[model samples]
Target: MKRILFVLFCFAVTSSYSQNKISKNKKAIIASVEKHKQSLIKISDDIWALAETAFEEHQSSKILADYAESQGMTVERGVAGMPTAFVATYGSGKPVISVLGEFDALPGLSQKATPDKNPLKKGAPGHGCGHNMFGAASLGAAIAIKEQIEAGKIKGTVKFFGTPSEEKFFGKIWMVRAGLWDDVDVNISWHPSASIEADVQSSLALIDFKVEFFGQAAHASGDPWNGRSASDALELYTAGVNYYREHVKPTVRMHYHIQDGGQVVNVVPDYSRLWMRVRDTKRSGMLPVYERVMAMAEGAAILANVDYKVSLISGIYEVLPNREGGKIMQSNLELLGPIEYTDEEIAFGKGIQKATGKPEVGMDSKIKPLEPTREHPGGGSTDVGDVSWNVANINLGVTTAPKDTPWHSWAVVSCGGMSIGHKGMIYASKAMSMTMLDLFESPDLVDKVKKEYKERKGDEVYEAMIPDGPPPIDEVGN
Candidate 1:
């Protein structure tokens, strides 16, 4: 009889243990995200439908702000003097985790999801970068976390940052300059891509500048030698830069195009402009070369007898990899799983690829992961690099469009408003939310990330490379 009682007691104890484990797992804050997947998909679709452009995402901002506010978050608008930038905060305490969201469309990428290329509206802007999914996924994660906090399931704050003008202007750079990320413990961000992976790499430090030359306009044939040509100055500048390229470091990249080079060849062109980008591994390394490039512009103006103006439009620092934050985000990505394409989605991706005459359905998976503390340079630039300097940040990418679908093209734009894009957005949101939960549950992780950031930063302070003045956000194009 005693042996029988012992067996029953042991069974009861095991059952109780299993039940407790289930309860604990149910309390996992990431479940909040899974529970609200449909809502996230809807939000992503709505933002895609809006299709607002950089610095002009009023509708996108409104939609995000309204949703955040509806979820009981305190919404602050017009951050850093950017009309479309905002911050939505929830929860009242320490361990602040920020999720960065970008909602900017590319110009001249208007397209509808058809087998052949077709635009919804010819010459209209479209979300070629899938920023429509970006803002929505960010808001979705924020809302889910807010729900958990309200339910007493978690203890921490979540902030959703609506950053605009990611395409043309550096919205996050301006926000960083305003010290918006100072109080945040860590930042979690992701981009829609052709795969699911944590970006454990650094991007190139970049600086955008515009050079304008002023000259007296005169009729070419009538006033023969009387006119000083700004067009002549521009040509000289281009030549000088081409010559200067050989002297600069191999890693340093410089590219530019003439924005305006006189309207008529018959007239001594009085106005000419050049837009240029200078990039390198580090801002410090890039500065001297940038100075030389500027000197080239001055020499061009001098030779042409024209007044020259150089304007620093925008700049972004290289991404500082935080081991702790990256590991946490990557583990979450593993948990969230990669984006799975449906039959229709796969067909859509293939259709876009066929239309573009690209060989693959997704980006080449050849890009390997970076070693710890080592940086891998991306050919492109992002405002997120600016935020990384101030906060413990981790970024990831999930496949959304077809492989080799050059960004800011109709091919990308066509898929941006479809299911394939929405699936990637949802996957990113789930990963971001899970990463945030890991941070909230383990404060030591946040500390470790900060320590890594400090060790990487050394004695250097993060100064804005874009100059002391604010960038002109109101300007349409650079």
Candidate 2:
């Protein structure tokens, strides 16, 4: 009995010591985030105000890149043929830890930083997806890790990727083609959400392409028989897609935007253009649907007697979730505890919830239990999904908006520019930076993450789904 008691006592001592050490390590990162809290908030707010879209985030990109440079990190701009994309690195050597930072805003979601749905500028761009917070928090984490490396508390290089155009073009796809993440041992990423969790679930694989129809124009009233209407082809294509939607699996999603159909009612359109997107739970599942949909475009052209062309914009793989990494992140989240809110903040959250037609649940401040990786997780697509295929990615979600508040909407835009978003940004920075400390401190942890990545990837290879040539930087701006 005495021997067993001694064993238990020794185990307790070791476990307590280990816990204390981890607490100490995390404290440093928390302090680092606090020290730079104001600057990070300013950065996030500045980007939110700029509200630049996709490849046009010149001012937003400069703010982050310049800050990185000022902090003594080597900054590389115009990376992977993207004028707004950049890479910032600090420290040197093995186990390069990369963090992704997106700064692009969505078009036509402009809103003031208020609970009410007030557009800061009507019909202008805004940070509806909280990317302004995303970029600032990620960079803050990287800088914290850099400080650790400087102080000799952690080893290995820390890299920050200033990824742009996530909303439209998936800029990381081009960066992947350029082999930007080939050598990175691990990547840490986070998104603003209505609830906090260590994200270990996959996202939708998506394909984006444009289809154009060409036909001979004729006067609708006078020479109707002579008209081979491209608009007819466009209509038929959409009809076919809608009809075929019922036959598809529940995981499949298709969307299209008609860019052109006709100039006026009096003339038959000679040209029609549309942007079509298809998505599935996996890339393998998405390809067959994409092919079938493309074939429908040809069939529609045949029916309308119009010439058609399809242009590949880009595609992205679903995220390969790393449970090993998620476990580490979950521990950090539990250690940090739930985020606290003042009465004003809670009321602000409730106001957003009400405006968005959700229960006035305010903010979900608890640390959500790390969920089991879903075989078919239902969510939107991301360029970071491509990055996950390339490197072991640890993803996190922290609440920056009211509970159940609509994403990519004015409610998100409003919260993202205020103190609500700032608090979540700081929390995410501490969580991700603490996770990075683990990767730098423990080689075994990094190996476990990479092992999970390899097992999930199996023998399949990663290939960028974008067309050959430079990213459509100039085209997207127009």
Candidate 3:
């Protein structure tokens, strides 16, 4: 009995000591991030200016990879069959904490830092979703964790994943397929948004594919009866998709872009292509919806008397948010407190809001109450959703744009290039850094996080929905 009591006492003492250590490390992480803010901002702005699109972010990837190398982290580039995807690591052993970074831009969103829609370059790519800030802030956090590891305040691994092509194609899908996340115990990722909050939400499962219709070419007025127009099949397929929308669940989202129609009014085009995106709250529901669309395409081909082919471009699962991990991140965000905005920043936000036809509520920088992590429906889709299924993941959003600001637009791009986005980037850096420190020092918390992941995931096995072939890196801007 006395020996058991002595053991209990020792355990208490050890726990207390570890808690104190984590507290010290948290402070260090904050300071370390503060130290790197300027460099991070520069890198983010440079990437924004470069505005490279998916699968083509050569210089952007190189910048982040090079910075990780300079920080003494072991950098491995061209991972998971992707030239732009890379990973950086420092330290070793259990409780591996990984941070995800993205540096890809959307096409045709070029805009300057001004409040009004000032195009930097017409029909050029820009950081509409603020992935430029995403990569820089996460890199800053990882560097902070590296500092903690170097100071001996924390042990285990600190990894930064340079994930590219998040906007159009999900880059992390191939990375996960290559087993890059096999050793990771916990993953933390952040996004740039119009509000600051610890997100405990799930994204949509999505499949992006292209349907090509093949037909015979003939003169429009002279031999119209002889030629089977491929454009007819493409139009029918798109119309079917739009009509089927009324029959689907409210959570389902379907969108498409017509890539080709016909060369001229005088001649019928031999080939036409249409890109289709189908999204749902879960993979189980999304699959059936996707299959029905495929069937519709076949029907369209038959009715139009044209051959058709459907090819997978990319696919991603919905995020499985870990509440325990989210709470950890939320606590850190709260501890960091709300981000402050300057009067100029507020005025800039108002101008964008007014121009965009939203209420001029300025910026929303308050630390919101902890949102309950439940299975709920959300609009967008991301490859990070794939990563969440593989490990315990934390999703966070920081206010880089103005309130009610539309994402994936020139307005978002403009705000991200200015002080509004810069301040949020630094705040996310500090918050993520502190959360890593918490996970490093708290083994019990890690155990709980992992156990919860297993319980939540249940016996359902995870398999990536991407095609067997490699990622379509050549199809950038398509």
Candidate achieving the largest TM-score? 2
lDDT of 3 by residue, 344-401 (tens): 9999999999999999999999888778766756769999999999988888999998
lDDT of 3 at 267: 89
Model 2: weakest 10-residue lDDT segment is 14-23
The clash numbers for all candidates, in the given order, read 6, 0, 0
lDDT (10s digit) by residue, model 2, range 1-478: 9999999899677556645756676788889999999999999999999999989999999999999999889999999999999999999998899999999999999999998889988999999999999999999999999999999988899999999999999999999999999889999999999999999999999999999999999999998899999999999999999999999999999999999988899999999999999999999999999999999999999999999999999999999999999999999887777788999999999999888789998889798998878899998999899999889999999999988988999999999999999999999999999999999999999999999999999998888999999999767743
Ranking by lDDT: 2, 3, 1
Ranking by TM-score: 2, 3, 1
Where does candidate 2 stray beyond 4 Å?
1-22
What lDDT does candidate 2 reach at residue 164?
94
Alpha-carbon lDDT of model 2: 0.93
List candidate 3 stretches off by more than 4 Å.
Answer: 1-22
What does the lDDT read for residue 260 in candidate 3? 92
lDDT of each: 0.80, 0.93, 0.90
Stretches of candidate 1 exceeding 4 Å from the true structure: 1-31, 361-376, 467-471
Q: Compared with the true structure, what per-residue lDDT tens digits does model 1 show for residues 52-142?
A: 7778788889888888898799999998988889999999888999999888888777778665678888888888888888888888778
